[model samples]
Target: MLLGTPAAPADAAESSLFRGTRQFPETALWNDSADPAELVRSIGFGAVGATCNPVIAYTAISKHLDEWAPRIARIAAENPTWGESQIGWRAVEELSIQAAKLLEPAFQASGGRNGRLSVQTDPRLHRDADALVEQAVRFSLLAENIIVKIPATAVGIRAIEEATYRGVSINVTVSFTVPQAVQAAEAIERGLDRRAADGLPEREFGSVVTIMGGRLDDWLKQVASTQRLLIEPGYLDWAGVAALKRAYAIFQERGYRARVLSAAFRNGLQWSELLGGDLVVSPPFDWQLRINENELPVVRRIDVPVDERIIAELSKISDFCRAYEPDGMTVEEFDDFGATRATLRQFLDADAQLDALVRDILIPAP
Candidate 1:
């Protein structure tokens, strides 16, 4: 408490969310078809980082192939030769680059930790291990302070190894289980060792394992009918939290630093535990907004071990299939794709800043 400071203002509390002890970075939703810079600026620069995805980026392109209108117009004015495809990729490249610039000071302060923006590879390419590695390398070329996001799939782990070997900052996304996280960590270590063997620097390589909390809940909810008979309400795996804690510890134990960033968090409950790691990435802006309304929870580290005993238990693909059966539904069970696309398109077109942002994004950064 400051002895001579004036009484706190009514909205002063909102400031806590900006620099809360918990890393409040989120899914940037770049495909919302909004000007990425305007969106980033609205979110503010401090304690702010972004998560990128192909699905969302495709969503952005479905609507944003126009001339500048809002804040992004400023960038478009400088560069008018870009086409739609270039614009789409530029939206990603630009955001990652600018987001890195936005957080450059923070990265400097943290000695290359925290203040990070995640740029993910195409999820459709999740199965091509070799291709995934190439994509990660291409995305990370000439960029610093950005984490190329990879899935924790078999192919994705292979890419993670390749990316880490190149001294690239990587954030492996869509991680759903303890073993997946552990595997990603192991792959990262292998890459670092390979780098050291080649007589290269390895300290700049960072990997973030995103444990998708809400998606698990979403997946569980999809099975609610069978779940009633097979599991309990919320029927959730509290053990997952413990699993993540253990994996994070294991990565550290192995002398590798793959940061565990809790991802797909649905609500404020995730912020309650003080899980120790380099940092944790939260999802959805609402949770961050809600955090300001309540007190920030003190996240702690749980003692869980990742050993060969557990890693071996988790490696088999057959075992995973048994745990997560894909008996959910078929394509015909959903509504028409055209109608959904039209609806989404109309909504995004309404954003005035999107066109300009796309244009400005592609111009060579000054």
Candidate 2:
């Protein structure tokens, strides 16, 4: 096959790729949705955890409006002074709390490591470390198995350390590169060190730093198109995969306790390539369905390096360089990274949409 040609899909077979992943206990599967039905299905497929962000919370509420619409209205009624944003956030909390219950068994089974419901801090608070830390601490109290998500932005790095010091297990989000992952993990370590110095009671913390590899791929693709750089489209997919593999290797070499999680998956390579590592691979419910339906082979490929030719080609992109190297980006530049800006905007838009959803119920158009 040509280097640029897309690989053929796995043939359907009785074997389940998701179930097959179970053979490698170090590699855990987490469903990327909070919708109860999807989560329930995912749990059956060896998913020990799930996540809820503004977009995911919005989707979960939208999917079960029959149950949530009245709840939203009652929340507004109870807090007469509350606006759509407050009411909407309350709904997000309730949705996350409900999802957390489903993972309790696994939470107990994994010793507080795998069965976590990751709920992200409000993106609107991205700029304020104090606010982010406050909200993350509160989210941590929602459920024993809850892991708060703070972005990998400059302020978020501060918040992650503070939140961890406050005993909030964190799942760093909106991170798309090796530098972002390592820095976020270091911040977590700092927080843990501070807590220990204070002689705080020992507790299990399931902290993870997410490398949104697919989003990195997206930004590089956009850069390529805008720059008129002639490149193999397939090579672009490897960009994120390469970044993730590098970040995982660094985490191992440096002994960073925070697990490296691969998020924003675009292709099977993101999951397949990272198999057999002690990390998390969270794919959206749809991707999980597609992989299961195809029954892709479950092979240990985390140690398998990407083709050198593809890496060399992707390195030509300046942004890919920033993502692929540890010193590629500084904490200060994280907020302005193309992928960061794009993802934050999308998350903020989803938050605004959630407010609108609550508004319609609280103040219907006459």
Best by lDDT: 2
**Candidate 1: worst-modelled 10 consecutive residues by lDDT:** 326-335
State the lDDT of candidate 2 residue by residue for 1-366, as single tens digits. Answer: 211112522232333444555577788889898887888777766788887678888988988899999999989889999989999999888888988999999999989998999999999999999999999999999999999999999999999999999999999999999999999999999999999999987777978899989999999999999999988769999999999999999999999879999889899888889889999989898888777666677888999999999988988899999999999989999989999999999999999999999988877899
How well does candidate 2 score on lDDT at residue 214?
94
Superposed on all Cα atoms, the candidates' RMSDs to the truth, in angstroms, are: 9.3, 4.8
Q: What shift in Å separates residue 190 of candidate 2 from its native position after superposition?
A: 0.5
**Clashing pairs in model 2?**
none
lDDT of 2 at 30: 90
Tens-digit per-residue lDDT, 152-261, candidate 1: 65556777888789777888765655556666777788888899899996465545776665554444444443434333333343323434555556655766576666
Report the C-alpha displacement of residue 196, candidate 2, in angstroms: 1.3
- The all-Cα superposition gives candidate 2 an RMSD in Å to the true structure of 4.8
Candidates in order have lDDT scores of 0.51, 0.88
Model 2 ranges off by over 4 Å = 1-15
